[model samples]
Target chain A: MATILKVEGLWKNFGGLTAVSDYFLELPEGEIYGLIGPNGAGKTTVFNLISGVLKPSKGRILFQGIDITWFRPDQIAALGLTRTFQNLRLFPSLTVEMNLRIAYHTHARSGFLAALLSTPSFFREEKEIGQKVDRILELFEMSDFREEIASSLPYGWQRKLDIARALVCEPQVLLLDEPSAGMNTKEAEDLAVLIRRIHEEFRLTMMVVEHRMPFVMGLASRIQVLDYGSVIAFGTPEEIRNNQKVIEAYLGVGDLIA
Target chain B: MKQGIRAEWYFLLGGLLLFGGAFLATQFLNRYLLYILVLMGIYSIATVSLNLTNGYAGLFSLGHAAFMAIGAYTSTLLTFPLALREAYELPMLPAFLGGPNFVWPFFPAICMGGVLASVAALLIGAPVLRLRGHYLSVASLGFVVIVTTLAKTMKGLTRGPMGISAIPSYTNIYWTYLWLLITVYVIWRIVNSRFGRAMMALREDETAAQVLGVYPMKYKLMSFVVGAFFAGVAGGLYAHFTKAIRPFEFSFFLTFQIVVMLILGGMGTTAGPIVGAVSLLTLRYALKPLEEHLKIYGLIEIIYAVLLIVVMLFKPEGLVGQKRGVKKITVGGKSSA
Candidate 1:
């Protein structure tokens, strides 16, 4: 598979503090990659950098071999790289269907003139988009609550809706920031299953930043460990479990589970 | 099929009721009452337009009055012949814009004014939409100040604060309400459209909106331009009805008043701005004599301020906000019932 996202020698700073330094990772297409670290390990910061919310102080980010180091968030999104926030940034006032429909805006064919004229073509396109929204909602088992306000949904459902929204963009790569951060174990397990199913179903490249060890281990085909804003370990889940650096970064080497 | 019928029936009934009420008011009310109703109709259009930006798009613009001023001046100049203007010793306007016997039809001139205001909004929105929240609000307020200053300083064009008078009285209760009907219908349709849904999404979460591929700058500019267009139309009608055009007419106070109307009725709701504008305009007209009698020239301002504070304290969502706990009843349920 081709590399969908490549980050090399990425550096970001805040005044005197370097938030992310010399970070590097490449996510190949059709695989689940995990970024695991403790608190303030720059996991979310890495996601923000990839999504173009923050510019890199130094180095390059290439999406499909195109340099997107200085692109705006929307520009990056239009290029089929999308992300969800760790804290659930779903549009609260909009319904679940609306939340997904809004994401399909770039795909929708109706321009301002089409809307102004309310032409037959505009209505046809609108009906098609509506059907697409319905299908996505049904896939997530959220069709029943399509008209309900997104903010009113339960926490677990909100997370699912967030992923559904990202899916509406028809992204090549989906960056999920702690998809199971606030979920119960059952919810977390369910989410892991959903993530794997979606990865396979859509043939998508996914990079998830998560602190939950079991969730990441269960879903990620490859795991990259971060410590102090740098990739400390890169290997399979089993290899990462036994690596001395990974053990030391999470727990002392002597305190490893095995 | 039944759902479509119900929706269409509701719309038709509501429209008919509004038209009947307007017709009755024109037939039975005194001239002063008719004039006040016309003002309310114009203000309803302006307030609804403002809600499209400040309420729906999450942009807090306070420069609506500036767009209104642009419309008022543009239409006034277009319709008022230079021969009459010169005979009255009015300050000379630009050579290209000025000339004896120049007179566009009233309706087309009003539309031209709206287009001119929309163009101004596009120019301003390109830079202004980059800022968010309070930053946007302040930038728009600055725009109003700039426009006011231009009107005050550009003596040759705008007559330097002396204001143009004897504007043709082409706006009547019927025309005002007809335009109001059109404004409300257009906005109602827009608010229910996919574009409106995207705007609401941006208001809910900017980051999420961008990730969803809903370009924030594009939606914000569209809302701003559309809002300014309606405001311009309102301003044109206002100028013709009042039979005068002045820069001070579209002041910060006017913008504040419209904001109050939106807040009072309910932000982000179809009926909110209309209810707010009509109620507040009625209250102002009712209290005018008392204000004059008490020699409290600023009483209106004090009352508005107090009302806004009270609303903020007790009902922050305003009067017509979507009820939080109420479940939306679908067509099936209604039909079964």
Candidate 2:
């Protein structure tokens, strides 16, 4: 399979502290890759770097063979890579439909003049965006909440809306930061199934940074364990589950590594 | 979609009828009332454009008065009569401009002013727009200071702040009303479109919007340039209506007043600034007679302060956008539950 996203020698520093050190990944096309680490193990930091939110102190990243290490976040997203935040980051005051439509910015071709004139082409593009938003809302089962303000939604729905917003952009590589962070076990299991369905439907390469072992383990085809800003093991879910170093890394933290 | 298109046509017809009504009123109304109406129209344009920048884009600019000054001066210089240009000892006109005995028409002069102001906005906004919040505000305020200082010291062009008078009185009620309609229509269209959505998204959360593929710099500069263009046109109208031009006329105080109008009317709503401008201008005119009778110099200013404070306390989101707020949250809450 073709490598869809590749990171090499990725390093992030905050003053004297190293948040991420020599992090690397070679995610193949259409693969669901898992990234698991303890709290502050630089998992989200890696996601940030990959998504162009944070510039790496020293490293390079390639998306579909295009170097994007120095690209701005918006530019990276326009290049067909998108991410969802661990903390929900919806446009709080806007409606759910508006939120999804806004994410279609990359796909829109109409300019200010077209919009000002209300040209037929502009209407066509807007109709296309509306259809996509409707489809995503239906898939997520949030069509009833289309006009609801994003911040006013229940917590779980907001989380679903965040994923929906990212999905609306139709990205080739999706970086999900803790998709099931605050959900119960059953909810996490449901989220895993939903994510798997999404992966199959969209045929997207995903790098999910999740804390819940069962959630990521069940969804991702391969798991990469991280500790202290570096990778400790990389293998299939079963192999990483039994890796001695990964087990020891989670030993003191009492994480479920079995 | 067809229904939406028909409704928009109806809106256009309504706007044209209102313009016709205003035109008739201008013929019969006394000079004082007409002057007040024209002034209100000019302020409406300025406030609406400012709303596009500071309200929708969330770029707190305090330099829009500088843009007005650029427009005022550009239009004034272009439309200045050849006879008066020689008499006032104005600096030589650039060769690219028409020669002696050639005076540019009013429409092109005003449009040229807007274009120049847009250029200036692009130049300054390219770098300064990257800064967010208070930094952007302060930088824009500094732009006002620079423009004012240049107007004061550029003796050859601005006559060293002695000011220019007897400018051609081409700005009648029709001209003012037409420009006001254009500004309102254009801004309304922009705010209802994709560009407007990108702006609101950026305003709510820059990071989220960025990761969603909304280029912040492009939209920020777009709003700034567009807002500056209308402000320039408004300045041109003010110059022609007043038949005078001066550097201090487009000062920080003018910017403050426009900002107040935007905040009081409702920042993001399309009709908010227009309502704010009309109400505020009417209040100023209504209080003028009382102030003269009581011999109180600053009574109007004091009242304005009190009114703004009361509005802020009661309607922090401004007056126009409040109706949806009270009902939507409850609906959202119940539905979510």
How many steric overlaps are in each model, in order? 0, 0
- DockQ for every model comes to 0.29, 0.45
lDDT of 1 by residue, B1-337 (tens): 1132255457768778878998999789898998898999999999999999989998999999999998888888788765687765554445665445557778988998899999999999999999988999999999999888898888767887888888888998778877787777666656656688778888888888877677788888889999999999999999999988777878898899999999999999888999999989898999999999999998988998999999988988888887542334321211110
Clashing pairs in 1: none
lDDT of 1 at A109: 69
- The CAPRI class of candidate 2 is acceptable
Q: Per-candidate TM vs. native?
A: 0.92, 0.95
TM-score per model (chain B) = 0.90, 0.94
Tens-place lDDT digits, model 2, residues A88-117: 788888889989989999999998898888
Please report how far candidate 2 places residue A189 from its true position, in Å: 3.0
lDDT of 1 by residue, A122-159 (tens): 66777777888888888889999888987677767888
Q: Model 1: runs farther than 4 Å from truth?
A: A253-258, B1-21, B89-100, B292-297, B323-337
Q: Against the true structure, whose DockQ is highest?
A: 2
